[model samples]
Target chain A: MTERIVVSPGDLLGDGVFETLHLRPSGPWLLEEHLARLVRSSSILEMPEPPVDRIRSAISDLSVSSGALRVIYTRSGVLNVSVSTIPATVLRERREGVRVLTADLGFTVRKPPPWSLSAAKSLSYASNFAARRWAARQGADDVVWLSTEGYVLEAPTASVVWLDGGVLCTVPPEEAGILPGITAEHLLSLAGPAGLGAAQRMITGAELSRAGAIWLTSSLRGLAEVVELDGVARDRSPWTPRLLDLLGF
Target chain B: MTERIVVSPGDLLGDGVFETLHLRPSGPWLLEEHLARLVRSSSILEMPEPPVDRIRSAISDLSVSSGALRVIYTRSGVLNVSVSTIPATVLRERREGVRVLTADLGFTVRKPPPWSLSAAKSLSYASNFAARRWAARQGADDVVWLSTEGYVLEAPTASVVWLDGGVLCTVPPEEAGILPGITAEHLLSLAGPAGLGAAQRMITGAELSRAGAIWLTSSLRGLAEVVELDGVARDRSPWTPRLLDLLGF
Candidate 1:
């Protein structure tokens, strides 16, 4: 990335909202939903609602760049658009299943702040990045944070999706105080009609481990299965390719 | 404040440490301690140890500007320096006291992650700035955060300092898992020989209200008395200015 973007000093304080979309050769996937969530996230920070039309125009003006399109909206009334090659590690994790760790998130979901942006993609992501970094230092690929009361939350960069007896389950973000994963939510919506059961439940990490299969879902990589969770090797499920194909990964 | 201070795109992320010192006409006050703490804070973030000789030369090259001197160190090995005037509200609060609100910080300080940057002057300060913004919405000058167990931790931008029975007390940073307040530590030390006692104690918001006097200490303002906390009036103690004088505020 070039250091050519001139932003106000306040932008560096992380008082903003952002969206990281899987930029394809044609266009950004799930563009509308990402834009909607960006506005919602900005509102939680008490920022003015961004101009969606201008954003769409900017998207239409783009060329054939299959990379990440990051839209950062700051409190200083700045909108930044930067592109870079899709992170190599994300691709590596997608090819080879990731090793994972788990820890308590230490926050209640029900009593989240009135202006909570948990369901929105916000820019205050240092803690999330730090968690992943911590996991890497511990020889794991990522971490799944549970609530202080032992309920599963989400991962550093992806949503938790696991197979609990034939039912594809993910925690209800509204009840879990987690960012609603667009890809995972879209996948779950399709599961029911495809002769597969879908459900949202408050689960414990141990309960997750007991499941037949577990996967981390996100936009870029689609779904990266947990090959070895905390050094305990697990067999990869045959559902991986099917789910990725359904999501057009 | 100059646009020429070119920074990498990654610098926009708040993975860094920072220090703001009171630049006097004489020199940078408490320069050595500030520099040491900056290094300590960087280590917590796993950043490289800054070159002390380079920093010392930077200070020597600075003009005699009596304002706030800020040093920012990022994990990506970037160090930046800038000078800016303190906000008018800071001086206003110092002279006329301030109204502060109490709120849950939503983090268990006691069990913070081993690599947590709680004691560091980090740049991932969106939450800190957000807390102060929350206070503004609640008609107060600032906020005092409490741990999940209701123990008073520290303010978003300053440290909590209270006088109980002529004894000055501030939270123990290591025990409380919060940042060590340099200004508060300095004042507490100066209070001892000035016929006042000093100590570190674990306190709660309710426990804090019963104190003889309350103050929020920082580098620039020195110390701002809390005449009203959560809307209740507090006694105006004469020790405020005396304590300030001892610290050359």
Candidate 2:
């Protein structure tokens, strides 16, 4: 589906929040979760409460059956919903996994500024994109950010999840003060059904290296296994396909 | 004059740079400096060099005089120039001074990540504006950010400038990894003509408190004297107006 939008200068200031969902034949995947995150993001930006009913109506009006759905809401009260085909790279990463690098993000987990937007997926995502580009320069498909103290944080655009001692775990959002990963949390909830344990805990880079399997989870990519990390190749995990199936990817 | 335009989804990602200039009867004040800074900002964001000739032509086409001139350029090669009346609060701040609060920005000066955009004046200004709103909630007009080590950094939207022993100084942009302040540099250049010395140095918050005068300098506000800092009232210095006149504000 093709779409166009008229925007004011203020809307371009990045003082906004947005949600990207994996549109399916049935509907956008986990849409309510994405919308809830959007509201949380807006609140962090100190923006007015988004009109959720209006957003739902807008999504229902879209003619495209499956692709990517984007909802953008600016502080200027502009709301835009559009549909487009998901990038081939996203699908490729899901099928083939991704090469990942680890780098110190230069931020301390314990001392965010009072107005820190770390917990919000604000539209100020230049650094997020920049980190990916820097990874590309290093010949990696993506990056997993580490806090200055060597603790594993989230990826640039995804949440870091791993299997350790038969237990599935992801970083705790509140303690890390990061954007809560909806997809990772959902996947963790499914671990019990898959005959595994689920938990949320902090891990250092060294501890992460010892995990049985590592993956980055997001809405569009679903779960991209870190097939290669820090130049070391990893054997394909048997759980990768099963987890993808469980998530309906 | 009012204007509207169409933007792509990528345009709202805050992956661009902008310059806010003071439009004057004789054209934009310090236009060259502002343009140079724009180039530097774009470079930091890995965007291609902005078309300087196009920017100059666009500025020449504006009919409005003596207001705020905003130039926005996205990574998608979209360039926009618009004019709007300066906010009355800006002029008032220049005249009446501002109550300031000092807060730890929770950023260490030495460890910015490889892809950090801290030095760029990118469109991702949501955090900057959020900090100001936070200051407002704290019963202050503005805030001066301090580094994690308690060194004085710039304000949310301006540079920190202070006077000591008849010498006027501001933090060095490169050393502080901040957006260089065009107005403050110009003011410093004119300090010799105003019978004062100029320098760039790093100082702690305590040292800044003991300075004869302190100010936050930006394009629109010119020089907002810090009349009260962290509940401690400061005496007005004679240099405020003389430097303002020298800068032709």
Which candidate leads in TM-score? 2
Candidate 1, A79-157: lDDT as tens digits:
6666678888888877787899887666665466443556666666667777888999999999999776778899978
DockQ metric for all predictions: 0.44, 0.75
What value does the lDDT take at residue A29 in candidate 2? 96
Q: TM-score for the first chain of model 1?
A: 0.94
Clashes of each: 0, 0
Q: Give the TM-score (vs. native) of candidate 2.
A: 0.98
lDDT leader: 2
- lDDT by residue for model 2 (B91-121), tens: 9999989999998887778787889888889
Instruction: For each candidate, give the TM-score of chain B.
Output: 0.96, 0.98
lDDT of 1: 0.81
* Native-to-model Cα distance after best TM-score fit, residue B215 in candidate 2, in Å: 0.6
Quote the lDDT for A6 in model 1: 67
Candidate 2: misplaced stretches above 4 Å? none
